[model samples]
Target chain A: MRRLISMLCLVGVVLFGACALGKVEISGLFMKQAGYQESDIRAMTEEFLKMRPDIDVKLSFVAYEELHDKIVVAAASGAGTYDVILLDCIWPAEFAEAGWLLDVTERLSEEDRADIFPEVLSAVTYRGRLYGMPWLNDWEYFFYNKKMLEAVGAKPPTYWTEVIDIARKLKAQNIVEYPIIDAWGQGEAVVIQWLQYVYAMGGTLFDEAGNPTMNEGKPLEALEFMVQHMDEGLFNPACIESFYEEVRRVFSAGQAAFGLNWTYMYNLANDPAESQIAGDAVIAVIPGFPDGRRSATCNGGMGLSILTSSQHPDEAWDYIQYLASKEVQKKYSQNALPIWKSLYDDPELIAQQPELIKVAKEQIHYIFDRPQVPWYSQLSLILSEELQAALTKAKTPKQAMDDAVSRTKEVMERYAQ
Target chain B: MHSKVPPTPSGMYPRGGLLRRRETAFAWALILPSFVFIGVIIFYPMGLSLRLSLFQVDLTRRGAGTPFVGLANYIDILKSGYFWSSVGRTAYFTVVSIAIEMVLGLFIALLLNEKFRGRSILRSLLLLPWALPITVDAIMWKWIFNANYGAFNALLQQLGLIEKYQPWLTRPWSAMHCVIAADVWKVTPLVALLLLAGLQTIPRELYEAAEVDGAGWFRSLWKITIPLLGPTMTVVLVLRTLDAFRVFDIVYVMTQGGPANATKVISFLTYQEAFKFLHFSRGAALSYLITLIVAVLALLYTRAMKRQIEY
Candidate 1:
């Protein structure tokens, strides 16, 4: 019996030692870019471990939809299974407010803080506390076929009305099957597109009292204008039912003359192997209102947040700082547009990719964040339903907006206290 | 088979009754573990779901105290337009899909029941759709219905059916039809298998006797095969109806209740409310409404089964 007990103890020690040697797992949802892959993360980890070999890191990738669902489940369970998590820019308020993230304000240095774009930093902060470090910066951009525009005797539109006129000309000349296409599906893309018009028309979804004012005159006017454009055949009738990939397919296939898409689509549209109109695609800022005021594009990207329940908070903080460093940012920006202002101004990289650098500079000032609330996801769904109702002609714009405002108010009240 | 014995010199009389009672108790003890397992695994979660449906709880709201709201959740669900719409949609889907599946599956089962060359190969081929995962099935249908470049449109255009490709999933009725078509493809095999089992159980003597009476093939099938298959058909319809009412994965993967909420079933709505919207209380309410619907259908099925069995 004594010998058997000693043998069991010896085996337990061996198992525990093996577990202690296991690598630290860091999981994230990476945006699929030109050269971003598991090897790039492995290379970064190896370099970081050269200075501190005591900590080991492993990486996991999730698709965008899966990532959102996984994070919500993980955070709600308070399992602390993920030591480091990648969160979208708009998620910090909800995640941080739920106490799922560690407050990282004191961990970051003032110099490191200054290195990030102000808009990006502000987006991830809530109630004057930094909860995450910005990793990437994304904004919507306009993609137009230069050859198609030239054939139709139209230049790239600089204003909303000019865009409609260009679409009309393109249609008349048969330069493109669909003159314009945007992601109007019941998803985040539609919300972003709606924000563009809302901001252009100087409207807001909420007031000081936190009541949704979407039914008011200005927002209604903007929505009506959007519906009218669809009615006038300035945009594809199917745009109201399209997801990102669908719109991307149309634009890439040269069926659409103009498209509003993300910065990452620039490379995809310009790749001759993937695109028929490779050399003809031109990247420009999303068109502004006719009154010379540029409309705002929804700012989207990911941030590094340490799980509050994490046992290895210190190590996780180290990883966050490493990811936020200027050197790492520059390296990552080669494939992804890092949120650091220093990397955006890097001369050598900019010389290689002038269009990307130009886009980064142009969109920086026009970036706007979505509503930061714990129930933002629910609000987004409600808004999408209302928008779809109006687009499908099932309900008048006023009726849909009124219903949406009432539903939002009710949901807010339910979660109030 | 034995009788009680007289007492011995040591006063140890035959105590067969007590001994038999003890043996019975020992046997029950041996089977108690399995009973405990079934109770814990199956009944416990069901009981928890029932209790949760009575409370006002939001999983996303960390540290919020859940209050006992009694039947408020259920009442709210009954009163809400969204809940009724989803319920109506689920019912419509369940009735349409089950009816179509039953008729097609019965026909296919009858075909396979006949002796034919390559019958075994055809049987195996029919099972392929059911054998594939729901996600794969959804993706296959999605590609088949792709607006610009899909096999369906290609076939149609080749036959000069239309001038341009039709957006099958972009239209309301077409989207629902597409989902139903995919569902029929996936579930018909199970229905056919069930009907095949029922067909096998019919006594060959009855068919021989019917032929002796000069009953034709169609008459034998109508009078003998279907009558004897009534119990099995009831079971199949009940099972299929329950499954069809709760369909989620395929629609979720394919359209996600899109094209203006034409395909929004109760399960999908419940999932969206619970996970996507993070309104756990509302989700619980919707789930209970689905349970109520399934229970009513089951009761009706039980009554029909009882009548058939009695006949």
Candidate 2:
């Protein structure tokens, strides 16, 4: 019995020592939809695991809609639920303000900072402090069925005016019921699309003195333009109920001559298995107003962030660095563009999707951000509801903008207090 | 199957003895776990939310201290246009759906109560809609009402009722009605089952006596059936009203309170305030208001139920 007891004690010590040298387990939260596909992420993780067998990663996914609230809840509880999380560009202000994200400004080297696009880096920065590494690089691009444009004997449009003329011809000839389709749904999608128009029109939501400028100038004009075009049946009425997925489906169905969506749509739109107008679908720069500015696109990049409450912050940061590394990102450039500006010049990288890389080079130059505020969610809600009111004719464009202007001013003032 | 056992003596369970004490102690021991469970599961959150609501707890405001600004959150909610409009929408959903459901449920229950062929199979089949999960039911209805390729539009088109497919969920007014329709469709079956149970309890002799005295079917329905079914109807209304007034899942799956916030019910608003915006105190206050509204509604209904109709 004494010998058996000593042998058991020896076994217990061995097991504990083995455990001390075992894998460091960390979990990451990623959205199942858009940007990097699930299979791509799993493959990336598998590769990462092969390289670092001493570290174990557990990945979980939620829909994009649930990602924000899920992060907020997990962070608020201080539960260390996730070590790494996918961060939307619009969320950094709110998350950083809540102190839910790790401050990693000093971790980025000068060489690393210089290689990445400044606009891409801004997605992960709040108040000049870097919080994460930019991973998915996405922006809206104009898509058109080449056949429909050819049927109307029109060339590819460079200006909003030229697009309008082509859309008019397409409508008059009965080539399509609606020449243009967009996602103007009642959420962040609506605000992003609307802001793209506002940016294209050379409009700012605030003046130099930080006064609200939504009720006048091009912001008001943008809303009026949408209401008028929708009434003329140029914009699809169904867009009011559509999100990005719906926009992709509608554009792929050959029901619309023109549409705007993020990078994922380009591949899906041309896939023979997914689309009816597979080969004819072409991507170009989203048009801008000739009188106002050059091409404008809404920045839709997301980032790899380490949660402040993560127990294994070093392991999480290592995983994020691996995911956002130039080589890994360049290899997985099927769904999205790489954030590194140098990759755009790489022969093999450009060879994968030459047309997209060519347009993305110019499009990235014109990328504009959504308003980065801590109360952005509230501001987004106000924008979505007011924009819908104008679209649905519940209020005139002027009235809707006026209400939005006042509410925006009030929210800013509250924050200022 | 065997010989009968004798009855226990009257003193077997003496009220004032040591065995009684031991039995009492055992009963208390068995009940203690559930009592603690109720306190933890139900009362703990209630207390936490109540405490949180009294303070200004906006997480997004970073270092802003959570001050005890009692009743300020409630006042702000009452003053907000969003809250009042959401309340109006919730009321519209509850009243319109319950009115239609009660009438339709009673009519279906009356028909099912009659002698018929394949009655047993029909009765069992009636439960399918009620048995479906709300998420699945809402998703099914969302597809059925899809603007581009929906079964409803196809049916309407085939019948020459319209020239083109209508955007049913795109419009604010129509979207609310579509949501109410989805809720009503899933719930009316359960309502019918409840009414059918009440129908079974009605004595057929009352109808026979009335018929002998020259009363017709409509008269018997109006004079006898309706009044006796009052208690069951009251119970159904209370359940349906509470459920409809706090609707979130169907609206969430279908419209998500879209197209100018037309279908934004109170619970959806509360969710947006708390989680989406991270204004915990405001959300807590909004949820407490919901609790108060439901409690008051249930009380009024039970009061009506208590004043039972006399024959």
Candidate 3:
């Protein structure tokens, strides 16, 4: 019995020593994706591990809707479980303000900073300090069925009014039931989609004093136009509760003539295996109003940030740096539009994803980042519900816009106090 | 299966006083672990939530210290239109769903308790829906309620019940009913099974006696069966009411209070305010209000149940 106990003690000591000598372990939480995108992220992790055998990464992925809440909950607990967190474009302000993220401004070298796009760099900056490394540069693009348009001999619209007119013509000609579908679900998607219209109509959500000014002028007109389309049955009724995936599925199934979706949908809709309208889908820049005002799409991109609670911030930063490197980004740019500006003109990349560079270049020019406010999630909730209320005729467009503005202003005031 | 034994004689417990005290202490010793466990897991969270409700804490706002607002959070929730609307929706959801579940569950339990062919198989089959995860059940129903090409619209179209596929979840009026229907489908089996257990406990001899007394089937059910099942009905109602009042998973997975915030229940609203909006203080206040409501409901249920049990 004594010998047995001694042997067991020796084994335990060896195990403890082995564990102590093991590589540094870091956990990352990211929003879940599918197909090549999911696999591409996995490959990136493997590559990072290969590059630094002294570090091991545990990546956890969740749905997009749950990612924010999970990050907030974990980060609010001060010392969270995750060492690294993938944050949405709008959440950096809230997370940085809460002091949950580590400031990495000094960590990034000048050359590394210069390699990334200025707009993408600005996205990760909070209150003049950089908190995250930009990874995925996402923005909306207009997608239309080539066959559906050709069936009616109609060209893709350059303006919002022409979109409506073409939609009416397509329906009258029995080419398609409705020509437009949007990710107008009562979530962040709706707010983003609605902002496109808001910006297209030459309306601004906030003024010079940072007050919600959506109650009148072009904002109200834009909202009324959206509702009028819904009333006219020119918009897909299902779109009232559909998100990007749903919109992608319906449009790729050739059920709709045109849709407003993110850049990622292009790959899905163009892949013959996943999409029914693989070759039939074509991309275009988002349309503006008939007044020839500049068009805008919500600038949506996710970045990797080290949590303040991370025990191994240096190791996490190493992996993040590897991910944000131009070489890896060039390889994975097809999965998520690369954040680095230099990769856009890479001959090999342009050959691989031809239209991506073209359309993304234009879309990036008119990118409208979500309000850079700390209470953006709450503001989005208020705006989206009010937008839905207007669309559903529960409240008039004017009333809905006015209510949204007042509620947002109230929130701002409460926060100020 | 044996006859009742008579009470022990006085000599059997000459030192009953000391023994009783020791037994009481032993019983407490056995229960002490569970008591502590419950106190930590349940009561501690409740106390913390109550305490937090008195303050103003928004971690999203920079330099926003947790101020001692003392009933101000509750006041703000009361004044907010969103909170009241959510409360109204939750109340409506609870009442309507409980009503539907009780009636359907009772009838199904009655039918299930009968000695019919395939009764055993049918009994096991009824548990399938309840056995599935709520998220799975909700997602399945979401697809069924889909606007473009859902099973419901397809079935209705085939039967010529409607001219076209209708978006059941888009409209406010139909959306609530759709949610209730999904919830009822998922939870009604548990209620039925509970009442079925109650029905099985009923003595066959009492029904035989009623028949000999010239009481019809309905008469015996009304006079004997239901009266004996009073305790069971109260348990079922209380459980169902509490569950329905705090309905979140189904509404969350299905509509997410969508189309126009038509199905935003208090619980989902509180979750949004707390986690999504990062307004933990307000969420706690709303949660406490819900807890108060539930406590009152439980008290009323127990009081009414006591009278029924006595009868």
Candidate 4:
């Protein structure tokens, strides 16, 4: 009996030791190309450990498109595999609504709350609750080849009409093959650009009750303007199939005179090896509408959230806070735009990377988020289809908008009660 | 009464009696692990999907419970024009892609059957497309089909075939055809290899006998080659048909069923419904519907296989 007790005690001690040494797994969509290197992550992990040595952090990198799917699968199975997650801004509503994330509103201090941008905060908030911390903030900015603009005897366009006029002039000069390019593929990227144009033209997609009103005249007028640009050859018809990478390639090759893209392209465009006109490229705000209202760019960024099933919420929250801190944000700003407002004004960093600073400041006033809803992903797809149909001449602008509104209403009604 | 009077020794007992029972139990134990694996991995999820399909669950709502709503998901999916259209589109893609692949694959296999110089090298080269990953192939084709800078348009313009670039993946019919072309290019090699294996089993003596009878090449082919190749062709067709029916990766990467869902297949639609739309239950329902159709095909294939075996 004594020997048996000793054997059992030995087993218990071994199990305890195994459990004690286990690492807290935090899954995120970080890639080397996206500027999150393993060495950098390891350095960050060391810093985190110095802050709290009791916690052992294990990071799992997932591809961007696969991240949400992995989280959904893991969360639905009640698996505490992912204690921390990096989510897209639009995903928080669906994830939090699904009870997959821990509500961090009460955990955040008032000062911490004040540090985050309001637009980002609104994106991560659902039903008066915060579910995520903003990490990186992205918005579209206008990019123009300074040399090409000069060669065409034109200046950078500041308004929508000016943009069209410059394209027309460039086309007549035959200086560049494609005058302007934007991501107009049948995906979220195209929908994001379309929304910017629609809002610039003073169109609204939803009413006070959160009901879709895209069939209205204002929205139609906005879509007509977009189609007119395509029809007039200001924008390439090939844009119907072009994605972000394609746009980047065309602009980098100096075949395109002007382009509108997210802030991440700034660094790539500035690289002399990758770009033909690297030093001569300039960044500015997207051209405003004829009515003087500046176009709103769709928000594109990632947020950090803690899973509700996590056994290490406190540790995960610490990591989130660390990522959102001013120091880390400054370091992150060197590669990608950090969401914290303080980093935008950092003189040293701005002086070192003027184009990045220009993009940060110019995009601040025009940043807008997609609809905050659990079904936003689906809604975005529906919007993309309808808009593409109009752009491709498969459906008239009015008919397409009407179809989108009706379909959106149907989906909203299905989810309402 | 006689046996009770004098029970046989244990060793003297018939080996079939006790040993058979033990062997049966041992066999079951060996198979039990595999049975459990299949039940957990395949059947359990399928059963859960079946249950979810009957419920009104979004899985995207916070604290929202899956409420029982029998046949509602099915009714909704059936009622939607989008669902039926995607199904029709998927069927069209499968039939056309499989037919073209089979014909082209058979022709290539026959051509390669002839003894030639660098025959081994040619066989290795044939596998290049099949060896490449589906995503890699899709991306390569996307660039190749690019309207302006693509190799196809460049070649066409060089030959003075057309003055301008064609929007290959933008228009409705052209987009679907372009995807089919890419699909056929990537998978025809696989079908060719399978048919080549079938051709290798054909005896040379039969062709010699046909030659002695003055039967031409086409006559011998029709009389000897095809009849003997029946079982192999059936297997290849069944496998390719099923694979083509579930085609997703190529379309997803290339066009994303784009330009107004012109090339949207059933799998893509289910994926969009589940992951993209967060309508998990609805997506599960659609998946089961697809499974049912595929299962019917599998049953037919099984019957055909049984007939082949009997023959």
Candidate 5:
């Protein structure tokens, strides 16, 4: 009994220590390319604390693939595991509908709201209620080897057919083994990359009534174009399992004349320490179709949101405001693409990231987003599988799209009931 | 002849009455905590899942209350091509991995049984693969199977074994087999270790007698070693079968059921249905179905081993 009493006292002391040391904990992904690394975020938190000494902030960084699942399980349990969550733009609708996020619509001033790009700003808004502050505005970009094109006396392709024709010439000259490489693995990466073409062809994944319609028309044409490139040896066969990082590696090694990847690759490809063809690499808009439509880029950005179960939501919101402020965003622009509209034109900012001002301005004009639904994850999986089937020649492009359409319809019906 | 009944420990205490009840109560007290632990950790969640499997529970849309849909989730799963394909993939993975692990493990176990130079060091070093965590092993194998700079293709090219590099994880069949190979490499050491313990328990005198009777090594192995190792092999088979059937980590890390869902096992599908899709009811039903399959496999193996041991 005496020992038990001492143990109880020890436990009480530890509990007291825990309570005394408590702070508002938040979590986000740590990707160097996205500029959300732990060291960078830690520095931001240190700066945040200097302004508000009364509030203590704890930051947790997980990998990009793991952050979403961690947030989902924690928020689903209403466990207050994190106060602030950095979310992919696609997740805002699902999380907001689940009542897992604290609405911040009225929290923003009119000027503050107007400064953000309308397209990016709307991604984190579900049904006219803002749940997140748009932070990193990342999207896909086309990278090409300028030296390779120049050697063949060719300019960068403005259309898909032009790209293929250039690829044939480059291959014939033995300039590079494969002319085009993309991150076309059997995952969401491939789906997002493929959507650029689908959108360029003026295709919608779903009808306005929220039913899949990728079986006919331009979507099928886009898919067939992708498979034909692989069959014709224009696309690197290794792309069947390559993700963005692998694509970057292939492009940086000067093994491919053209590559499709996210914005991060631009910085990496130009860095002499990271790339073999740093001097030769240049960025272009992803090519459109033969019909003279604008090339589309997928809406790929992330935001910071306050979880509904936060113990110190006001403090979390303050931290988000500071991070999303123009000054700090300007400071971090070297690491990531900032979402502020004014930053695009700011002389100092444009001088820092010249490619952002010159190319991304046009890239922003053709932004396309995935269908926003609670079942988006399932939808991506179903569609990617069918795409993979076509890529692997298990089914023709038409059959694969038809299968994807029917399976997606079934998923919709199930969710509807 | 009538057998004499043994007297009770205490003549003052009745054998068929209050004293026996006291003993029963004492036994219950000893086991009650363990029972409670199992109930909370295992049985309770199982019961909850069984209940949830009959409901339409989508936590994303919480305003839509979970309506009861008895057997609907099960029916949907049974009819779904995705679920059935995953089940087929899981069975193929389990059977192929177990066959490979058993044969490789048995050979290793047999080799280690013989006295050799540095036998003790070899025994400890053989466990290095199993000692590493599954995630670490899977990541290492992922690099090896990479298309361009992977050691696998590089080695094959250097050896003049193939004309060019193969994208091992891009095709459906190759991706499935690569995942299986990783699983086998990580777990074969464990099977060997378990069989090693069983091998040590076999009496040396039996081998000596077999040798005296002019039995060759192969003859003795076929006639004696295998016969005595039946129970152990059966145990290994059941355990490895169950483990392979519920495979997740290697597949998730390597291919993620990719190259057209060829590597997607039942567990991976269950995770997608429950976590990614947030279809908790369907996930629960799928999980219980998996549990039923595993339970049946375990029961059959144990029953077969019992009969074999009796003979």
Candidate 6:
């Protein structure tokens, strides 16, 4: 009886100690790659915990490819395993429609809404409802090898036509066997890369009623451009199986004069340890078609959302707000840029990454989003396969887009019920 | 003679009946744990999955609620062209991989059965591929088949087999074959080891008898070796076919059903249906189809085993 009393007393101590500390523990799920690095996130979490002693946040990371499925499984299980989750821009519609995230529209004040970039805020907004807070601000930018351009005595191309002319000249001079490279592998990467072209050509993927329109518009023309360049040997043949990393590798090795990748590539390509021709790489606004927009890029940003299942949503939101707070965001701006509109003009940030900031400001104006619908995942998968078929020359761009349209129609109809 | 009586239902002498009955009870007690294990781990989930399949359980449509759709999920799956194509792809992968693995396994088993120098070490080393985790094996093969810096391209180029590096996985047809090759490499060792055990069971006297009858090595192999290995060969075939039919991890890691969905097999399709799309009912229904097919194969296996050859 005495021993039992002592054991109960010990348990009592631990219980009371936890209660006395006023601890509210929350866990977050984040992607391991392409945004903030794991160490940076951990450091930021430590700082947040320091600032809010009552709240404890545990974090987990997964590859970006696995993030969507992981989030779905966790949310659908109805287990509050993660109080916070990182959400991609394209997922807001699907997630909001499913009611997996908290309705956070009323959480933001008018001042905060006006302070955040409208384009960046679109990362977390679905149908006028704000589901979360935008955090990672990213988009694709055009990367070029400056020495290769210098070899040909050419300037940065302002339009697709100029890019083609410079590519031809570089090819003729035998400076690089393939003057351009892209990530056209058989996955979401292909769809994003293709959309950049579509948006650059001043085309939208759907009608006002959201019907598919790829068969007769600039989508078809962009695909034709890609295929024609691949055939002409101006674009590398290996890109048919390459992802973003592959594009980075080929470009960093000086095997290609031009490449397209996300903001993460800008730092890595210029890092001497990561690249062979480190100093030769430069970033520019992605080129557009002569008869279309001046520039266009895809929005690759993500947001921080509170799961509906979270027991302590207030604490979760507090943690999220702290992570995206201007102070923390600026401190960790090495990987992803801040989402605040006011931060863009900050002299400190501009001085920290002068070249990247300059190009990013220009690229930010051209950011476009992929289709934001509840069936977007299925749509993206279909687009990836058809785009690959066209890229591999098994189907012409016209037939592939037509088939994609028909297939998307069937999928959309299935979801309509 | 007067003490003689009609036989009991058990047909046992009355004296030992109790003991035998106790032995039977003890036997059940020994296997009770396994029965409970199977009941909890296998049957419970299977029952739940069956219930799930008869309804429309899409989490993406949360407020709509899961409605009983009966066999609609199955019907829709059967009607889909993607499902049919995935089935065809799975069939191709299963047949081709099993064929290659069986042939290679039997040859290696024959070679291992021979008494030669360093044979023990070779046998031990042969188990390495089988012992490796499937993901590791798949990743290794992906690197080997990489387009830009793959060892395959380098070797082929040095051998003058091709003028330029070939994209082994970028093309649809080649991608499927590459996945099959990875599966074959990972599974052949277990098949060989099983066949080796079967080889060891055959008596040396039969080979001597064949030799006395003036049978050549080829003749003996065709008649003595293969005939005696029938049961083991059948076992290998059933095990490999069931395994190859549901191939998932290797294909997932290597190709991701890519290059125009060339390597997209049925299991990968089921994964996309359930997990990626959040359509649990359709996923459950697709899994039920696989279970049905596997059940048929298992029945055939049990029946074949019952007619096993005995010396």
Per-candidate interface DockQ score? 0.41, 0.69, 0.76, 0.60, 0.66, 0.57
Off by over 4 Å in 5: A18-35, A207-211, B1-30
Candidate 4: regions farther than 4 A off: A1-23, A31-56, A60-63, B1-16, B62-64, B300-311
State interface RMSD in Å for all models. 2.1, 0.9, 1.0, 1.6, 1.3, 1.4
Q: For candidate 3, lDDT tens digit of each residue in B1-311? A: 01222355865533445665666678789999999999999999999888889988888875868889999999988998888899899999999988898889989999998889999999899999999999999999989988887899999999999997787888877889999999999889999999999999999999999999999989998999888988999999999888889999998988889879999999999999899988889999999999989999999999999898777
Error of 4 at A225 (Å): 2.6
Q: What TM value does the first chain of each candidate achieve?
A: 0.89, 0.94, 0.95, 0.88, 0.93, 0.93
True contacts kept of 3: 0.88
Model 4, residue A222: what's the lDDT?
A: 72
Per-residue lDDT of B205-248 in model 5, one digit per residue for the tens?
99999999999999998998888888899899988988889999
Clashing pairs in 4: A97-B61, A97-B62
lDDT per residue (tens digit) for residues A189-210 in model 6: 9999999999899998899988
Q: Which ten residues in a row have the lowest lDDT in candidate 4 chain A?
A: A28-37
Q: What is the TM-score of each candidate against the true structure?
A: 0.90, 0.94, 0.94, 0.91, 0.94, 0.92
Q: Mark the 10 consecutive residues where model 1 chain A has the least summed lDDT.
A: A28-37
Tell me the tens digit of each residue's lDDT in model 5 across A1-417. 999999999999998986787754454333333445466678877998898866777667665555667787888788787888887878877888778989988898899788888877877888888998888777787889999999999988998889999999999999987889998887787798778888988888878876788998889988999998888888988888888778999899998999987777887788899999997889889888878466989888878888998888888888899988888888777656778888788999989988766888888888888888877888888888999999988899999999999988887886676
lDDT of each: 0.79, 0.90, 0.86, 0.81, 0.85, 0.89
Ranking by DockQ: 3, 2, 5, 4, 6, 1
Instruction: State the lDDT of candidate 3 residue by residue for A209-314, as single tens digits.
Output: 7778898888888888888897787898888878888888889888888899887788889899889999988888999986736678877777899999999999
The alpha-carbon root-mean-square deviation between model 6 and the true structure, to one decimal in Å, is 4.2
- Model 6 chain B scores worst on lDDT over the 10 consecutive residues at B1-10
Docking class of 1: acceptable
Instruction: Give the best candidate by lDDT.
Output: 2
The TM-score obtained by model 4 is: 0.91
Please give me the DockQ of candidate 4 compared with the native complex: 0.60
On residues B9-71, what C-alpha lDDT tens digit does candidate 6 reach at each position?
876646556755676678789999999999999999999999999999986777778999999
